[model samples]
Target chain A: MTDSPPREPRRLTRGEWLVIAAPAAWIALFFLAPFALIVKISLSRPAQARPPYEPVFDLASGVAGLLEKISQLGFDAYRGLAEDTLYLDSYLSSLTTAGIATLVALVAAYPFALAIARAPQKWRPILIGFAVAPFWTSFLIRVYAWIALLKDEGIINHALMSLGVIDAPLPMFATRGAVIVGIVYSYLPFMLLPLYAAIEGQDPSLREAAADLGASPRQVFLRVTLPLSKRGIVAGVLLVFIPAVGEFVIPDLLGGSDTLMIGRSLWNDFFANRDWPAASAAAVALLALLLVPILLYERAQTREGRR
Target chain B: MSARVLRNATLALGFAFLYGPIAILTAMSFNASRLVTVWGGFSTKWYSALVHDERMLQAATISLSAAALSALIATFNGLLAALALARFGAFRGRSLFAGSLYAPLVLPEVVFGLGLLLVFVALDVERGFVTLVLAHAAFTMCFATVMIHAALKDCDPTLEEAAADLGATPLRAFILVTLPLIAPSVVSAYLLAFTLSLDDFVIASFTTGPGATTLPMRIYSQVRLGVSPEVNAISTLLLGFVALILTASALLTRGRAKGGGAG
Candidate 1:
C-alpha cells in the first residue's frame, strides 16, 4: 500500500461556499422570489393597464408614500373569492373531485402494484417497464389520447355501437367521470411505483411465517401486507392528491363546465377576466388549503428519514 | 387455483387499463383515413405531413433546445445543491434551503406559473425562452437535487478519502473519483429534467411569449381546435423516441449493474 498524504480535517471551504451559493441564489430568485411576488400581487388591485396589477410598493416614492401605497393594497381579491358563489363552489368542487380521484387512483394502483410485486423476480423489471413507459410520453398527449377514445363518435362508442351494446353512443366525454378517469390514468404510475417499492421491499419471511402458522393468504395480506405498506400508501396518496387538487389540464380537456376545478377557475381569472390580483389570491388560497397536506408529507418524510 | 387466476387477471386488467388508450393513439397515427374512429389501410402520410409543417417544426426546435438548456443548467445547479446538502454538515439556514428546494415538487404548476409570470412582469423582463428555461430549471432542479443527493448519501466517502491519500487534491479527487461514481445519477437527473421540460405544458403555457411556442403548446392549440392524424403522428414519434431512449438507458444500467455494482 502507498503512503497516505496528510489527511485534512473536515471544514467548510470557500470553494464549497461559492458552489453552494449558486443554487441558493437561483432558488431564491426563481422560486422564493415568485412566491413573494404572488403574495404582493394578491394584495394589490387589478389594473386596467399593462401588467394588469397595481404595484404594492414603489421605491421611487419616499417612506410616507410607501405607507400610502401599502395601505392601498387591500384584500379586495380575497373578498372576491369569498363573496362569489362561483369561486366558493369551484374550491369545494376541486377538493371533492381531487379527493375522489386520489381514492380512485389508489384503488386501481394498489392491486397493480401488488401484482407486480408478487410477479416472478425475473419479470419484475419488465412489469415495471410497462407501468412507467407511458409516463415517459407527454402528459398532454396522454390526455389527448383519451379524447379520441372517449368522444361520442370515438373508438369506444363506435366499437360498442357496432356490437349492438347500445342504440346510441353513451355520453362519456366532458363529464366528471371522464375527468376522474383522466386523473387516474395519468397518475397511476405515481401511485403504483411507490406501492410496488414498498411491497417489494417487505420481508417475505413474514408472509411465510403467516403461511406456516396456517393463516389464510387473505388474512396475511390484510394484516401483514397492508400495514407494512402504509408508508408507501401515504406517499402515493400525497403525490396524487396534491397535484390533483390543482389539476388544470385533465379537467379542462375532459371535464365539462360543471367540473369547476379551482385550476380552471384560476386560469379563467387570469386569462379570461384578466384579474391578476384575483388569480393570485385564488392561488394563494389553494396553496393555503394544500399546506396541511404538504406539512404532513414533510413530517412524514422526515420521520421516514429518521427510520 | 382460483386465487392464482384472480391475481393473473388483475395483472392483465391493470396492464390493459394502462396501455389501452396509448395503443389507440399509436394505432391511429398510422391510419390512412383522417377520421377519428375509422381505419383505412396503414399509411405514413401524416408523419410526412408533420415534417412539412413549419410551425410544428419550429415549435419542436424551440422545445428541444429549451429542454437541453434547462436540463443542463438544472443538473449543474442541482449537483451543487446535492453536494452542499449531503456532504456538508449542518449549516445556517440549511433547513430553509432544503425546504425551499423541495417546495417546487408539490407546488401546483398553476400557482408557480402565475407567480413566475408576475415576477417576470414586475421586473419588466421578456417572458420567452429565457423565462421558460428559468422556470423549468427551477422546478427540475428540485428533482435533480433529490436524485443526486440520494446518490451522494449512499456514496462511499472512503473512496474520495483514498483518492486524496493518493495525492489527489480535494477538487481533483471529487472530479476524478466521486464524479465518475455518481455519473449515472447525473445522467438520470439530466434525462429526468429533459423529459419534464419536453413534456411540460402548463408552466411553458404560462411563461412563453409569442413566437416561442413549444411543441406541447403547439399540440395544445391544435388539439383544442380538433383532433387530427398529424397530432397522432407527432405523438407516435415522440413516444417512440422516448421509448427508445428509455430502453437504451435501462439496458445500459442493467449492463453496468452486471459489470460492476453501483457506487
Candidate 2:
C-alpha cells in the first residue's frame, strides 16, 4: 500500500536482533518443542513411571543404542486408538456434538449479527459492546449457570411446573441437550462477531437494488446477503466447531456419562489412567482430525485480510 | 414495518437467551435459600459465606497473582513480537515464527496442556506457580501479539518516522510516538491476557501442581458436585468485578473521545 523507497540491504542491528530473538526463542522452545515432544511420546509405549512413557530417545545410549531407541518408536498408540471402540465412539460423538452446536450457534447468532449490523449508526458500538460483554465473564461460570437453570428442580423446570406445563420437573441436567446449550451459549459471540463484520462490511446498495427490483426481503437475504456473508458463516462455523470438538470443560461439566467426547477421554487417559502415551496419542489424533478445518480457517482469514 | 418488528423481536430474544442464565445465577447468589434452585428470599448470606471461605480466598490469590505476572510478561514480549511482525520488515524465518506464535490460538487446551506437562516432566521441572506462569504467558502472549499487531497496522507509520527524523533513535521513536498511539490496545491486550489466564481451567488442571489450584479449578470441582449457592456468590462477585472494570474503561474512553472532539 505504501510507495516508500526501498532501503539498502543491511545487517540487522543488535537492537533488532534483541526484538526478534526473545519471542522467537520462547515460542520455539516452549510451544514448538512441547508439540514435537507430544508427537514423540505418542509413538512410544506407555510405561508406569514418572514420565509415563518409554523415552523415544535416550541421550545416555551411544550411537547404536540411539538407533535402537529411535527404532523403538512404533504405532502402538495409533493401533490402540483404532482398535478400541471406545476411542472411535468418542471421536465420532465429539464430532457430532460439535457439528450440532456449530449449526445451532450459527442459527442463533445470525439474527443478532444482522440486527447489530443493520442497527442505527448511533447505537452500533454500544450494541456490539453489550453483545461482547458477556464473553468477558468467566466461561466456566457461564456453563455452571446452566446447571442452576437446567436441573430437574432448576428454574426452567420450576417455571414450567408452576405454569402447569408439566406434571413433573423434566430431566435436563447432565443431558446432551444441556451440553449443546452450554456450547451455544458460550460460543455465540465467536460466531456473531465474525458474522457481524461480514454483514456490516457488505454494500447496502446491492441489497437496496435487489429490493428496488421487487425482490422479497427473504429473497434478497437468501440471494445477496447470505451469499455475501458466506465468508463470515464459514469463519464462525470453524471457530465454534474446532473448539467445541476438543472441548473438555463443557462436555465434562454439562454432559452425561453417556455423552462421550474425545476430550474427556483424553483427560481421563492423562489424569485418571496416568497413560501419557495414550493421552498424547488422543491429542495427536484430535489434531490430525482438526488439521483440515484449521488450515481452511487460516486460509479464509488470510484471503479476507488481503481484501 | 413488519420487517423491522421481526428484526427487533429476533434481537430481543437473542439477548434474552444470552443473558438469561447469567442473570439467574446473579440473582441466585443473593438468595437466602441454601439450595440453588430454590429462591427463598433475598439475603447476603452467601456473600458472607464466600468471604470466610479460606480455600476460595487462596485460589483467588493464586489466580490473581499468576494472571498479573503472566499478563505483564506476555504483554512485554507480545509488544516486541508485534513490532517484529508489524514494524520490522520481513526477516529470516519470519513466517515460521509467526506460524508458531499463532498455533496456540487454535490448538485445543488438551493438546497444549498435555504437551506442556510432558515437557515439564521430561525436563523434571516441578509444576507449580512457575509452570503456570510460563504456560499462561506463552499462550496469552499470542493473543496480546494479535491485538497489538492490529493496533500497529492501523497506526500511521510516518509518526514513528517523524520522531526518528527529529533526532530520536529508533527505540526512542517507538517509545515516544508509536507506543502512545497503541497504548489503549496494549492495555486491552493486558486485560485480555489477565482474563484468559484467570478463566483458564483445562490447562491449569493439567499444569498446576500441589497447592496451586486456580479459582476455575476450584469452581470446577465444586460445580461437579452440584450447584452450590456459594459458587454462585463467588461467580457473581467476579462477574461484578469484570463488569465494573469494563464499564469504567468504556466510560473513560467515551469521556476522553468527547473531550478530544470538543477541543
Candidate 3:
C-alpha cells in the first residue's frame, strides 16, 4: 500500500483549501442540491401555476412558513406513479430491454475482448483504440445511423432484397428490437474495455497450468479464465445496464411509440405533460432502481483500486 | 492456425459492425438523391444545404461556444478535484465528495437534467446559454476528474516531495513540475469534456431554453421527424471534427512519447 505515512496533523494551507473547496462547493450546489430539490418537488403537489408545483418553500416566510410548507408535502406524485400502469409498465420494460441489451453486449464483447487481450501486446492498443473510436463520435448520430439502416427501403432492407434474402423489407425500424440494437451498439465499448482489461491482466501461466493438468480447453476457460474475469463482467454489465435503463436517445429515436421506457416516459411527463412532480417521481424511482447496481459498481471499483 | 483464423475473423466482424453504420451514414451524406438509400451520383449538395441552414448554423454556434466554455470550467474544477482526491489523502467529507464526483458519471442524465432544471426554476435562474454551460460542466467535470485522477495516480509522488524539499512552494512546484507532466492528460480531459458537451442531447433538452437549442437538439428534432440527407451531412461533419481532434491528440501523445524516450 502506498498509503501516506503518519505525521502530525497539520492545517491545510490556503492553496490546498482552494483545491478542495472549489469542486466540493460546485458539486454540493449543483449535484447534491439538485437531488434535494427533486425529492422536495417529488413530494409537492402539482399545480396550475408558474413553476407548476404548490407549497413552494419561501425563505422570507420564516420558520413557521417553512413548517407549513413541509406539512403540505405528501407522496401524491409517488401515489400517482403507483396507480399509473404506464409508469409501472415503462419501468419493467426499460429494465427488461436494458437487461437484454447488457447480455447481448456481454456475449458479443467477451470474444472480441479476449481476442484483443490474447493478441500480440503491440497490437492490443491499436485494436482497443479501434473498439473505442466509435464512442468518441456523437452518440445521437450513432443511434440515428441505425435509423438509416433499419428503416423501410433503408440500406439493410435494400441489400437483403437484392440478395434475395427476403421478399420484402421487414418492419425493422421504430421497434423495440431496433432500440436494443442501438443500446448494444452504443454501449458495446463500455463492456469491451473493462472485459479487455480484466482478460489482459490474467496470468498466461495459470492458463497453461490448467491445460497441463489435463484440463480441456473448455474446462480451462470455464474454470480459470471465466472465473478470473468475473469482476470485469460485473463491472461491464453494471456500466452498460445502468445507463441503458435510463437511455432516452436510443429509445426515442429508434423505438416505436408503443415502446415504453422510463426515460421517454419521464421526458413526456415533464416536457409534454408539464407534470413536474410526476417527472421527479419517475426520476426518483429510476434512481432507486439503479442504486443497487451503482453500489455494486462502486464496490467493484474500490476493490480494484485497493489491488 | 484455425483458432488464429477464428480470432481474426471475429475481430474483423466486430470492427465491421462498429464502423459499418458510420460508414453508411457518411456515404449517404454525399448522395445527390433526396432518398437516403439511392445512389444518384455523389455530390456535396447536402453539405451546402447544411451550411445554408439558418437554424443549424445558430445551433452549431451555441453548441461550440457552450462546449468550449463548459470544457474550460470542467477542466479547471476537475483538476482541483483530482488534486484533492489524489494528493489530500483523507479529509472531511471526502467520501461524500468522491461519491458526488462519480455519481454524475453513472446517474441517468434524465435524473440530473430534471434535477438541475428544478433547481434553476426554484432559484429563478433563466434557462439559457449560461445554464446550459453550468449543467454541462457539472456532469462532464466528473469525467474530467476521472481522467486526470488516473493520470495523477500514475505520477510518482516523490518528485513533488523532492520539489518541496528543494524549497519550492507547493503551488509553484505544481505549476512548474507537476503541471508540465500532467499537461497531456489535462488536455485530453478538456477535449473529452468538450466532446461530451458537444454530444449531449437529453440534458441539453431539459436545461436549455427556447432559442438556445444545441446542434444535437436540432439534429434530434429533425431526426425524429424522419431521416434527411442534410442531417447526415451535419453528422458526417461532426464525425470529421471529432476524428480530427482524435488524430491530433494521438499525434501529440506520440510526439511526447518520442521526446520522453530520447530524454
Candidate 4:
C-alpha cells in the first residue's frame, strides 16, 4: 500500500568496498593461500638440511635448495605415485570401492526414490523429511554407531545368534565388505535427495500418456522414468561416490586399519612422516584423482540442464 | 513367495536398519552394563555422570562457539555470494570463482585439513580457535551458498524489479523486497552450516590447538581408545538437540504455509 523508498542512485561506496574487499582478500590470503603454498612446495625437492624448503620463501637459507632449471622440477612425486606400490595400490583400492558402492547405491536407491516421488502429495514432504532426517545428527555419531553394530560381539551378531541364523559370531566388522556397507549407508542420503528431486521434476503426464497408449507399468517406468531421471541419477551417483572415494572418516572408523585407503595414507604421510613435500605431492595426485568425475558430472549436469 | 509382500518387508527392514542403531545407542546409554552394547538393566548414571564431566563441558563450549562463529560468517558471505551470482550475469571469470567455491566440497577432509596444518606450520601460525573457525568456515560456506542459491532460484525477481522502478534504491529494494522473500531460506542455511561445523571432526582435529578441542575431537579420541557410556549419553544429547531444531523449523515453515504467508 505504501510507496517504495526513493532511489539513491548510489555508486560503489567506500563502506561497501571495504566490506566486500575484506572477505575476498581474507579468502584469497588464507583459504586459497595454502593451495598455492602446496603447489610451490611440490616443485621443490626434499633436501637434507631443512627438509623440503622452498628457495623463494627462505631467500638466504640455501642456494642448493634453489633449482633454477625447470627440468629439475620433474614429476618425481607423480613418478613416485606410479612406482611407489603403496600409492598405486591405495589409489586403485579407493577407486574400486567407490565405484562398487556407487553402483550399489544407484540400484538400491532407484526404487525407493520412485516410491517417494509417486507418493501422494500430502505425504511427500513428510516422507522427504524422513529421508533427510539422518543428516540432522552429527555424521560422526552415525558412522560410530555402525562400529558398535558391526563389531564381533555387537548387536547384529547377538541378534543373529538369538535367531539361530548362525552358530558363530562372524568377522563382519573390519572387512572390506563392511567398509562398503558403511560407505553406502553414510552416502545413501546424498543419492536419494538428488534422485528424488529429478524424479519429482519429471512430467507425470508423460507416464499417463504412455499408460493410455497401453504401455505396461514396467515399460512406463523404464522408458518414461529412468531415462528422464538421468540427470538426477548422474548427480546422485557423483555426489555420493566421488566424495566416498576420498572419504577419510568412513574408511578410518568403519574400515579396518589395514584397509590402506588413499585418504588414510595421505593422513599418515603428513602427520606421521611429517614430509611436507611428499604429502603435498600425494595430495596433488589425489586432487587429480578427484577432478575426473567432478568435472565430468558437472559438465553433464550443465549440458542436461540446457536440454 | 509373494513379491509385493517381500518388497514391503524390505522397505520396513531398511527403515529399521537406518534407525535401529541410533535407538540401540540411546537405550545403551541408560543400560547398567559397564561394557558398552551389553544390556543388563536401565539406569540414568551416564546422564548424571555427564553433568559433572569437566572436560566434556569445556569441549561442548568450544564446539558451540566454533559452530556459532563459523555459521554466522559463512551465512553472511554465502548469502552475498549467492545474491551476486544469481543477480549478476557471467563476469570475466565467473565460472572459475564458482569452481573455487565448491572445491572444498570435493577435496578430501584429510587433504584439506592436513594441508591447512602445513600452511599454518610454514607460516608459524599458532593452532588455535581462530584457525579452527577459518577451516570450518571455508567448508561450511560452500554448503551455505548452495542452500541459499536454491531458495533464490524459486524467488520472483519481478518483485525486486518493480520495487526498483518504483524509486527504491538497489540495496533498499534488496532489503525491503528480496530479503523478506529469502529470509526463511537464510535461516535454514544458517542452521545447516551450524550443524556442519558442529559435526566436523576431521578438520577440527588438524586445525585446533591443545586447548581448543571440540566435542567431536574429544569423542573421536575417546572412541579410538575405547567406547564409554558417557559417549553414548553425549551422542544422544547431540542428536536430540539437532533433531529438535530441525523439527521446530519444519513446523514453523509449515505453519507459515498454512497461514498463506509463504509460497
Top candidate, metric DockQ: 3
Per-residue CA lDDT of model 1 for B1-263, tens digit only, reads 78668878999999899888888899999999998777799999999999899999999999999999999999999999999988776665666788888988899999989988987887898989899988888888998999889878877888999998999987899999889877887888888788889999999988889969999999988988767899999998888877776776566556545544633
Q: Which lDDT tens digits does candidate 2 get at residues B1-263?
A: 88688878888888898888899899988899877656699999988988899999999999999999999989999999999888776455665677788888898988999888887887899999999998899889999999889878877898888888899999899888888777877887888888889889988888889979999999888989998989989999888877776776566556545644564
lDDT of 3 by residue, A11-119 (tens): 5667789788889899988999989999888998889998898855778999999998888777999999999999999999999999999999999999999999988
In terms of lDDT, which candidate is stronger, 1 or 2?
1
Query: Can you list the residue pairs that collide in candidate 2?
Result: none
Ordered from best to worst DockQ, the candidate numbers read 3, 2, 1, 4
DockQ of 2: 0.59
Q: Compute fnat per model.
A: 0.71, 0.67, 0.73, 0.33
Candidate 3 lDDT, B1-263, residue by residue in tens? 98899889989999999999999899999999988768999999988887789999999999999999999999999999999989987665666778788999899999999998987888899999989999999989999999889878867788999999999989988998888888888898898899999999999999999979999999998998888999999999999999888776666665656655675
Chain A vs. native, model 3, TM-score: 0.94
Question: Given candidate 3, what's the lDDT at residue B167?
Answer: 97
Error of 1 at A38 (Å): 0.4
User: Across residues A45-110, which tens digit of lDDT does each residue of candidate 2 receive?
Assistant: 988777778878867878888898877677899999999999999999999999999999999899
Q: What is the interface RMSD of candidate 3, in Å?
A: 2.9
Candidate with best lDDT: 3
For model 4, residues B157-249, the per-residue Cα lDDT tens digits are 899999989999878988998888778778888888898899899889888899899999889878776557888899999999888878876
Off by over 4 Å in 4: A1-23, A45-76, A303-307, B1-11, B252-263
Worst 10 residues of 4 chain A by lDDT: A1-10
Check candidate 3 and list the clashing pairs. Answer: none
